[model samples]
Structure formats: C-alpha cells, structure tokens
Target chain A: MTDHLVEGVLAGDRRAIARTISLIEDNGAEAQATLAALHPHTGRAHIVGVTGPPGSGKSSLVNALALYFRRGATGERGEGGSPKTVGIIAVDPTSPFSGGAILGDRIRMRDLAGDPGIFIRSMASRGSLGGLAWATADAVKVLDAAGFELIFIETVGAGQAEVDIARTAHTTVVVEVPGLGDDVQAIKAGILEIADIFAVNKADHEGADHAVMALRMMLDLDLGGTATVLHHGRLMEVVRTVTGGEEPPSQGPLPPARPSAWRPPIFKTIATRHEGVVDLATAILAHRAYLEQSGQLVQRERERAAAELETIIQQESLRRVLACAQGEKLAALIDRIVRREIDPYTASQHLLGG
Target chain B: MTDKKIRVLIAKPGLDGHDRGAKVIARALRDAGMEVVYTGIRQTPEMIVEAALQEDVDVVGLSILSGAHMALFPRIMDLMRQHGLDDVLVVAGGIIPDEDVPALQAMGVKGVFGPGTSTDTIVRFIREHLS
Candidate 1:
C-alpha cells in the first residue's frame, strides 16, 4: 500500500504526495514503508535553508520566494506542473510542555497553497536544542524523492546552534532586520559564519543602513581583510548626525570599522511588501551557482547525508538502550552515581555493555 | 478534574511572529489538564502535521495572527485527509474574522476560537469536540 502511494507521489499526483507526507510525518508502519520504498527516488532536489532572528521576516521572505518560484517574471516553471517542483519545510520551535507550534508558516505562504508545482510542510523543533525538527531531514528526503526541484527549509534563528542548517541545507540564508541593537555582533559569531547569503529585511525602517554596515564590518573582520572602500552612504549619514555637519573631523567617535575578506553583499528588503525579493532570489541562485561551480554542492549533500545517518543511528540506539532499562535498574544506577559507587561514565559503559 | 489529558498541538503557521495569544492558550490548555505541544512561532503546515503525527495528538490547534489563514488552514486539512487523520480534530484560534469561520469549518476545522474568547471556552470546545 505504501509503495503504491510512493509511486503515485513520484508520478506527480498531489493526493499521493500529500498522503505520503502525512504517512511519513505520522511515523506509522505504512509511512516508514512508504519512505523506505521511496528512498531511492530522492536526492534530485536542491535544498535551501532560510533562518535568522525571530523578527527578521523569514516567513515573508519565504512566502515571496515561493511566489516567485510559482509565478516569476521569467516565465519559469510553475510550481507543480513545471519540470521542477518546489517543496518547503518550515521549522518552528515547539513548547516543551504542550508540544505545539505557536506560529504557522503555511498561513503566511497561503497564496501558494493551490499551486500544483509547490509542496509546503511545516515542522516544529519539538524543543530540540538545534532549533530544527528531527523530521526535517527526512521530510526533505521525501520531497526530493518525489521530484521537487527546490526544497526550502526555514528555521528560527538560534545564535550558535543555527549552524546545524549548514549541515542540512545546500545553501543557507541568514536574515537580519534593523533595530536589533548590538545583537548583530552576537549573531556574527554564531550564524553569520554559516550564511551564504545575507539579507537585511525591513530596510524601510531606521538604522537599516547601520545594521547592514555592521554586518558587513563583521564579515570583513571574520575574514581578516579590510573593506576596499568605507561605506560612505549610511556611515556618512550617521556621521552627519553625530558631527552635525557635512564634514566632521576624521577622528570622530563614530569612525568606520575596518573591513574583512568575505564581503557578503547586504541586500535590503521590505519583505512584507515583497520589495527586494527578486534580488534576494537572484543572490540565492547565484550562491547555488557558486556552490555548483566549486563542486561544494555535492560535498555538502554528502556530508548532510552522513550526518543525518549518524543522527538516526544515535537516536535509535539511545531509544533502544533506554527502553531496555527497567525502572528499578535505572533508579539503582542513579543511586550508585549519587553514592559514588560508580561514575556516570562507568555506569553508562556497564549499561551499554550489558 | 478526572485528568483525561487533552493532547493538543498549538501551532503558528507562516512568518507572523506574534505569539502572545498562542502562549496564553497553551498555558490555558495545560491548566485545563491537556498535554499541550506548543510549537513556538513560525511553523509551516507540514511541521504542524508532522508534530500532530509524532505526538499522536487528539487535537491539532493553530494560532495564526497573520492574515494568511485562508491559504494555510485548507492545506493542513488536505494534508490531514491525505494522511487519513480526518479523525484528529482541527481547530484554530487567532485574529480570524467572522466571515472566515464557515470556510475554515468546511475545511475540517471543527471549531474556530477568535480573540475575546476565554481560555475556558477553548478548553470546553476541545473537550466537547474530542469527546
């Protein structure tokens, strides 16, 4: 039954695709069988992960991207009917206690719901440390096997753990907005390193220029190089405010910071208005082109596959080991650790060995 | 309080970051003796469905402050149908207008809880529907 569904999905039947995804999400025997049968058909799609700060308009951007993929000025492939289908995996964080997703990504991208060329799925992190749902990789695989042209995985921006997207997605987009304070510095160390494209959304707001400059400066410093030219536009505007004159002393307190080697272009956007989305998409495509040219696309996919395989093994092994331990034995082990009869390391070794 | 757990998945679909209502409802559901799964902000329909499946939840609730509810709810319903999860009750609460209620209900959403609705009302709705 599951194999039939998989075949139907591969044949571009929306009902079949929807059913297969549902089965996979349910993790039922049928869903597992469906995935196992469909695994061979996966890996044709390009996976792109979009993440950023909480209010960085990631959803709007994703919505706009989906729209473009569905109906672009270029008369490209329509969502489902086109030669390449698109799949979206929107990842939201789940509440530890209630296990529900607070926000819905599908609602934002509602316009594209009926597009035959596109398939979108929302996933919750389920209180996972990495801010990505455990099922995200598998869902992407299902979409790939089902013959999606592009798979977009959107996640909430966690400072450090966001690097996990690098391991899953072929291209990573880190979004930022204005008025986040000096938090950009914090994001720099964690997310900036992993981003192939840097988008500054809500550019209509004040301090957008400063935010862009700050990000550019951070990128330059990380790469250990200097920006060829100081960003005179926004920086000078700030200088005008500080000095209260067109030309202030060169040694002003707001002196421009030195630049770095990798200067990721800071594109401004009013994502809600769909402004600058085309450029953003262009940048994303360009980045993918770079990856392909550099042969990093294959390498990234290989690494992601290996990592996913390892994660599955670890998770299944842990589940089995924990399930095998009875309540009394588990309690006795904890007691031994408390009494120092054996260290936690030794106890785990013994339990695993047994 | 017989403690019959109402396992609910409170999901936010799309890019809207407003979660005050989702959080409040999650708390209310928890207080109502329901094991709530709150997928914190910016979930897609796929993610919500996956959570619903993994949690083996009885009710799948969504909070969409964004106006994209029209597009989002139906897709979820379709996914639910495809997965043969039509038995799992679908409900929504957020900035939904009165006009959208019928359409949402037609899409298999058993109930629509909008603003000004009390937590007790939501709880009772779930209890009533699930029962």
Candidate 2:
C-alpha cells in the first residue's frame, strides 16, 4: 500500500500525496508502512529551512525563492530538464486550548499556487516546543520520496526552541529586517547560530544600512574577527580637530570587539518586490554546495536523524504514559497533584510503573 | 451519531499583524463543530502546508489583510499540488477585493470570503464543499 502511495505521489497525484502526509502526521500504522516503502526513493532532494523573527517578510522571501528555483530549471544544471518541482512546509503555532492550528501561511505565497510543479502544506506546532510540528520530518521525507528537487520548511520565529529546523534542514536561512529593536541582540543567541545565511528583508526602509552594518559587525564577531567600532572618543577628537577647541576627546573607552565562530552572509531584500531573491537563492545553493563539499551535509543529516529518533522515542513514551493514566485514575491523579497531595514526578512514576 | 466535522486551518501569513478576522473565523468554525487550527500570524506557505498535513485538515483558510494574497495563494496551491493535496480545499478571507476573487479561484482556491461574511456562511461553505 505504501508503495502504491509512493507511485501515485511520484506520478503527481495530489490526493495520494495528501493521504500519505496525513498518515505521516498521524504517525499511524499506514504512514509507517508508507514511509518504509518510500524510504528507498528518498535522499535526492535539497531541504532548506527558513526562519526568523516575526514580521521579517519570511513568507515573501520564500515566495521569491520558489520562483527562483523554478527559474533555475530553465537554465543548465537543471534536473528533470524542465520546471523544477518544489515542496513547502509552513509551520504555524497552535492555540493551546483549541488543539487547532491557524494555518494562515497561504496569504503570502499565493503567487506560486498556480504552478503545477510546486506543492505547499501548512503545519501547526500543536504546542511543540521546537516551533516545528511533529509531522514536519515525515512530511519532508514524503516529499523527498515523491521526487521534489527542493523542499522548504518555513518555521515561525519563536526564538530559542525553534532552532530545531537547523537539525532537520540541510541549509537554514535566518531572516531579519531593520527597526526590529537591537537587531543584533534580538537574534544573537540560539536559532541565530544555526543560520547558514541571514536575510535583511524590507530593505526599502530607512535604517536598512545601519541594520546591514550591525549585521556585518555581528558576522565579523561570529567569524572570530574584530569589527571596527567608531568610538565616541574618536568622534570627539575628530570634532575637536575641526573646531580647534576643548572637548578633550569624550571620556568613555572604545567599545570592545567580540570575535565569533561563523559569519553567515547577510543579503538585503524587499521581499514584496521580489528584489534580491535571485541573489538569496544563489547564496543558498552555494551554501548547500559548501555544506556538501565541507562534509557538513553528512554530519548534519546524521545529527538530524539522531534527533528525530530521540523525538520519536520521547513522543511515543509520553503517549504511552498518558494513555496508561487516562480515565478515572488519571483524573484522580490530576486532582491529587492539583491539591498538592502528590507532585507531578511521583504521580508520573506511579502511573508509569503501574 | 455526530456528523463528521470539517477540519480547517486558518493562518495569517507574512508580516500581517492583523488577526481579528482569522480569530473570528476560527471561533466560528469551531462553533460549527469544525476543528479549526488558528496559526496566529506571520506564517509562510510552507508553514501553512505543514499544518494542513499534520492536522489532516480538510480546508486551508488563509486570512490576508495585508494585500499579499496575490503573491501568497499561488505558492500554497503549488505546494498542495506537489504534495498531492489538490483535494484539500483552499480558501481566503479578510479584506480581499472583488477583482482578485476570480484570479484566486482560478488558482484552485475553493472560495474567497471577505469581511462582513458571517461565520455561518463560511462554515456552510466549508461543509458544502467537504460534503
């Protein structure tokens, strides 16, 4: 049955793909069977992850990137020797109370829907800590097996936990824009470290240059190099030289330069205009090549596989523990915990052991 | 026996900060006994697709008040096609002008709902399509 699903997917049957993804998302017996059958046909596609702070035009950037990939097929080095097929996975946060996802990503990427070669799916994190829905990896696998040359996973910018995309994707792009308040500090830690490329979207804004300069400085820091900082003392000295008066070179010492481990390239773009998309795509492809050449691809994929296994185990274990405690016993335990009679850990242990 | 519920994913894509309509539709859908996934704001086409796949949803409803519908809807359709989700109905709401409706539908969007559309109307449309 899984093989039949794979054959249908490869033949571009939308219903088959949908059903297969449904199976994977549910982690049902059917999905596992399907994946096992399709596993052999996987590993040929390039997976890219796009993530950034909210309001950075990530969707627009993705739209443009899809267009760029489609355009790439018209040139040399193209597979299928025709319009390339692309898969997109848009991950959105779910409402805690509703167990529902507000899968609103279609608004920004409507332009590509008409194309026959592109497939897009929206996923909800369903309160998953990593900003990646549990179903994402399997969905990507399904698309990969279906023979999409490029698969994009777009994640909501939920800061720390969202960095999981780095492990799942072959290449990760971090996106930002001007006026995001302390642009550098806003993304300095966690997910920022995982980005292979940084995009400065909304370049049409006034402070884009400053944002770019700050990003470059941060990149320099990441690369273990000192970035030149124009100190107030130096500025005062220059002012005094021009004025020939007594300001005595302002008091504060120069800002210290911090070195870094890797410097991701920053590209400016007005995502709505589709400007700079070509360059961004080129940089992404180039980065993919770099990863492959540097042997990072193999390492990354291994790490991703390990993490996925861990996640699956954790999820399965949690499911078992929860299922074991359901009904009257579960309700009673919850009542006890809430009433401070027993802690959650003890209750969990009791439930699991029983 | 209860009627089969319609599962809907209501998402806000790109930089649009407005979500009043998205939230309203989510509630309306839920009230109608359709499980709705409200993906807040700032979603990409990829995120929306992933949600639909995970939730095993029957409809993907996009709320775009930012006038980005033209550039966004097509990417979603393309993804649906690639993932073989053409049967999953795609709909759009929120501030959509009349002129773009035809184009949106042409791109495989099942329907477009603008402001002033009641929850009952939207829910009925989804049910009718699903049925």
Error of 1 at B56 (Å): 12
Best by lDDT: 2
Q: Where does model 2 sit among the CAPRI classes?
A: incorrect
Native-interface RMSD of candidate 2: 6.7
Q: What share of the true interface contacts does each candidate keep?
A: 0.04, 0.15
Taking all chains together, the TM-score of candidate 1 against the true structure is 0.71
Any idea what lDDT model 1 has? 0.70
Winning candidate number (DockQ): 2
Error of 1 at B57 (Å): 9.9
What tens digits encode model 2's per-residue C-alpha lDDT throughout A131-180?
68777888998888777889999997556447778777888888878876
State the lDDT of candidate 2 residue by residue for B1-131, as single tens digits.
11233568888877889888788888777656555756668878877776566456788889898898899888989987887677898888888889999999899998888878788888788888887
